[model samples]
Target: MDSYQENYQEEIEYLRKALAFIEEEVEKEAKNLEEKKSDLIAARKDMYENTIHASSDFESLVDINLHSMQINNYISSYNPQRFKNLKKMINSPYFGRFDFIEKGCSEKENIYIGLYNLMDRNTGRVYVYDWRAPISSIFYRYELGEVMYDTPAGISRGDVSLKRQYKIWNSKLKYFFDCSVRITDEILQEVLSQNTSAKMKNIIETIQKEQDIIIRDRDHELLIVQGTAGSGKTSIALHRIAFLLYEGLNSNLRSNEVVILSPNTVFSHYISSVLPELGEENVEQSVFDDLISEVFQGRFGEETRDMQLETLIHSRGKTSGEVRRQSIDFKGSRVFKQILDRLLWYYAHRLIPFEDVYYNGTILATRQQLKNRFLHNEIGIPMAKQLKIIETFLLKKVHPLQKKRLQRLEKIVEKSEGHEFEIKSFSRLLAIRQAVAFRERIRKFTIVDYRDLYMLLFKNHGLLLKLARGLTLPETNKEIILTTLQNLQKGQVHYEDYAPLLYLKLKIEGNDVVSGIKHVVIDEAQDYTPLQYEVFRILYNNATYTVLGDIRQTIEKTADGLLYDDISEILNKGKMIKLSLNKGYRSTCEINTFAQALLGEGTQQGYASIERHGEEPKVIPQETLEAMDRSIVEDIAKFTEQGYESIAVICKTQGEAEKVFGRLKKSVQLTLIKPRGGEVTKGPLVIPTYMAKGLEFDVVIGYDVSKENYVSDFDRQLLYITCTRALHRLVIYYKGDKSPLI
Candidate 1:
């Protein structure tokens, strides 16, 4: 595994030879041009000379207009096919659209010509160059070196270096100078020239460097990267796509296979720009919530993700109503998962559920149809084998449909008697194949253990199995069928567990099941439940998983669910790469400290977390509910007083968040951050904890921690999540029980 630079050398050599050959041809053409071609030749020759006075190439010296003309005119002399190919290269859809796409090598390989004039539209100067040229290395890396180019007067040298890798677009590179190649902006700019953004393309590009290392590691097919806020996790993932493309894996690896399950749809659009910068199209960007919604839609009839997260965030912390909170906790805990495990065993042995029971289109009639199936030595057979036998029985039932199909085939064959005679055996084989396929399809209508499904759905536990089973009943039949169809459409559905998503902590330690994928990367992994982790580990079959998260930021803890858990302990694989990001560039230092203290203690500080100095947190304590409403209204005086545009009224629960949000909306002109809103925003907002999870604010007014809200165990995590949403300042006023997080 050589460095990109080393690989660059090998790839660049062949390119240099090709370039020299083109240059020699250009010189020859310059000689053979008709006498009228003298002006064009002299212009091409002189453009390079003048631009080179400060170290430039012919293309670097021309404007877009001239460069286009130059390329069109010169290419006009080549074969029609070659000329068309050249034009295609210049206008390829994928080129320059994304960093990864532009860098990805198409069938054209590295074939490119030395266009004497490709111009920068902004500067009106020729600056286009093929990426394979020696100077293009600056596009991928920061370099400092000088460059040497052959000239009519002999060798020309220029000092060059790069300030940043990303900002080097549309610049000429000068990497070769004084015999040895080195990394430098001066050398790179002089040797290679391309146009790119300097302002947005900061070496300080908000993405962290270590994340870059993480993304580029080729061996990691499933890198579970858990990055803290502002850790550049998304940014690095985009860069990894580019690295993969530049490394020639683009052909085998598509942008689709590498998927990213973002927190929300808004976040997906927010982070879509980076991939294109590397010339790669965006991967299949989606939110897991939406994906899940698609899976369970119709069956669940639009179960809202916001509502789920809201329920989870509202539940975590409590100081009162201990018993009620504990019940909520247990419902979402490993004990529940254990119960699920028991239920799964029962289902496997004697209670599997079925969505439909249509043997030959008529209703299955009764549970007896499925009960009898289990009585047929199904226990001794493997599950797949049992399915096979069920298929055979269903095929016999569908034999009538096949007879009709066979009649149709016979009619068609009779109409083509001459051809049928010559292809009788072939037609017979085709008929048999089609009959088997149709029989297999008809078997899909039969359900195995429909009784078990009904029990789970109508069960008293009200668990996920019930939720899943309920989808198959008469009322839910169409919905469930539609959802299953949706899952089939995406090609990613895998139905695996019957227990609480958490209960298999130890049972799967060594159980071999589905052949595990080599790597497992869980995004937003910190939000996963303990039982979910247990199941996830088994799903990966002991493959190394990179779990990235900030424990204090758990936004979806059911009213009593635990906010903090040990990933290393739960995962049971101690290959932990702990990353602490304390400095949040999104907020001022004053905000960071308050948020740090807001999470209570010891949970603060990390890899890139910085304290951006700014305003102290503003507290708005209300003497009465009426006074609180008026106070919040009056506080929107100006951005100067409290940076009102950056202010937020944080609520400990979704119900509470909605209450104050509605009140504030009617009382004042305060703006609220919509659920899953845009990141680039400025306004006074009243937001729920889960909705505000990945966002930041300048000033925050903590709403309440009454026993009805934060006093519950689940509200603890919600409280922690809400307080940390502030970027600069935090303000808290409690009218009841003190927040456990505080």
Candidate 2:
């Protein structure tokens, strides 16, 4: 018997013990669940029967109170989730272990880490520690040396004697390694080499030191991560959500309270499974367009972000495209935001009509008094709240005056010629009509729809010039105005217009803020504009934000993507920290190198790649479109035969993808990903570059990289994003001449 055999035997024995304990715990929890169910049913029956025979309201209230107390007790005490966790543990108990000795203690503790903690029934010995526990930080942060971790009490100092990692499945240990470093490349290399999946995987056992720091960071309210492509920014953000929920850093933090704003619906579904794999519920996943739609409430025909990008991609060099480009640029700029701010000031101060609140013939609140209250008295209050206060004040003043006028009207009706009952009925009807008219006048004076206010600014060019405040307008300002007015006349709102509209709605209404959201995670942050960030800051004002993006992957040609300084200034309400993840993890060394070369020098200074090797990206030039199509089909078949599970033929626009998919559907089975669709599917997929953002494939085929398609500097980011989606293979096919970017 050698050391290997001895260790195997020990592992098997421990597995048996852990399995037995988990089964026992599952049984105990099952019994508790059944007992609670019975109790709950009995309590409901007792309440119903007692309430039916109650003599008075007090007696019924007593019965209801007793039932409510019973229900609360049951809900608090009974947790069937314990059984689910135990069942999950029976398959794979733990993944890593560390031997640690406290500073003054001679005995060492073996800390086994898993998704959830398990304890011995009688002796109260810990069988496994939850990976999110404070002590488990050592496994990700330190090697075999002096280490310390923060706890609720203080810091715990210890010396790590040994660190070990395991790969266990179905209660069987497949492999184990003893390492002196924190997270060895041996494990990461194996994990990274696996085929890409439709859903993302949780990287608990392979979290790097830097990633660990981000996962556990609770000090900063605004965390901005500018990671390169394939650097696990999305993964880090998801895991950080799980960490925040587990730590309960914000007293009773829940998964739903953490909102993740993904780039698209497909990307949202791509990351939906990460939290559940870590034994946490999925957080709220949404896109910016969804938020915009919610705010606008289907009042206008809105264009999606993907639709906007698609239009720009397909409409190069054309007059309408240029006008649309300028429109998006100006609308998404800080100058536009300033103009909107000035417009808001005008609406609040100058545009709104100030009239006296009158009842019948007398004024209840004078115009001067109302203006003083709305403008002077409530200087710092929100416009919506100030309007509300003025309404309430006007109503209060009208009540007494209204009663006196009605009494005088009754006297006049009695003095006139009429039957006794007729006089009474006539007086009552007159009073009702007068009261309704009075309230209507007050409502008309106090309430203003902001949408109309927005429309006014666009309709009146003189007003726009006054609000521009001498800022340099875009050269295509007239075209921008014309296009916007045309869209507005057709009851349509362009995607670029959503941010400004949302900003105005939120600023004036101030009722759209969702106070329940505690943490906000904005993925693909580079695609967002400063105006959009401002809207986010107002909407989730109470939430701590985690923004993740890669500036190099920004493909929105209409506007400059978010810059570090711009975001820092917009979300400056709390402590803001910016971190960068430069190492490429989702791509091979060859693919990363090829993608980085597209950006030129100085861009690769902070970026590094792992030791994964693959064939260099192939650039194939074709004589015609037919040749390019055939080449793409052949490569797809070859990659499929090579055992790649997920393959994509990415194009520059939806129209191109449709044409390619139409041509190839007969030869091979394919999934056509549209700009507006549900979850993304695996296997050979034909998708536009905009739709493929924040997704990875086992093999990617760039269908068209010709000089005609990618001719401008604006197309650089689109080309870069299209190339970096490949994990194991990348092939670029061009018709006629290859792109100058090559």
Cα-based lDDT at residue 639, candidate 1: 42
**Per-residue alpha-carbon lDDT of candidate 1 for residues 436-509, written as tens digits (9 for 90 to 100):** 55554444533333223423432335444453442322333333334434543443222212223113322412
> Mind giving the per-residue lDDT tens digits that candidate 2 earns over 1-742?
9987887788778778888888888898899899998898887787777665545688777877878798789878776667788888888899899999988899999898898889986898998998888899999999899999998988989899989888998888898888999889999999999899977888887899999988889889989888889899999998898889988854588988899988888888888889988778747888888877777887878678888887887777788788888788788878899999999788877876878677767777788888877887435666777888887677667675654664565465556535445555766657655665665677676787666777788888778878996798888887777777777878887889888888888887785447689889999888888888888888888888888888887766433334877888988856988898989998999999999998888889978999999999999889988888788788888888888989999998888889999999978898998766566787899988888888999999998799888877667788898888999999999888889987
RMSD of each: 16.7, 4.1
Superposed by TM-score, candidate 1 places the C-alpha of residue 490 at a distance from the truth, in angstroms, of 29
Q: Please give me the total number of clashing residue pairs in predicted model 1.
A: 94
Number of the top-ranking candidate, with lDDT as the measure: 2
Runs in model 2 lying further than 4 Å from the true structure: 45-56, 356-360, 400-444, 557-562
TM-score for candidate 1, please give it: 0.52
Worst ten-residue run, lDDT, model 2?
A: 553-562
Give candidate 1 regions above 4 Å deviation.
1-204, 226-251, 265-282, 300-305, 308-389, 393-446, 449-451, 454-522, 530-547, 555-584, 605-608, 640-646, 666-682, 705-716, 733-742
Model 1 per-residue lDDT at 642: 40
List the global CA lDDT of all models: 0.46, 0.83
Alpha-carbon RMSD, candidate 1: 16.7
lDDT of 1 at 6: 69
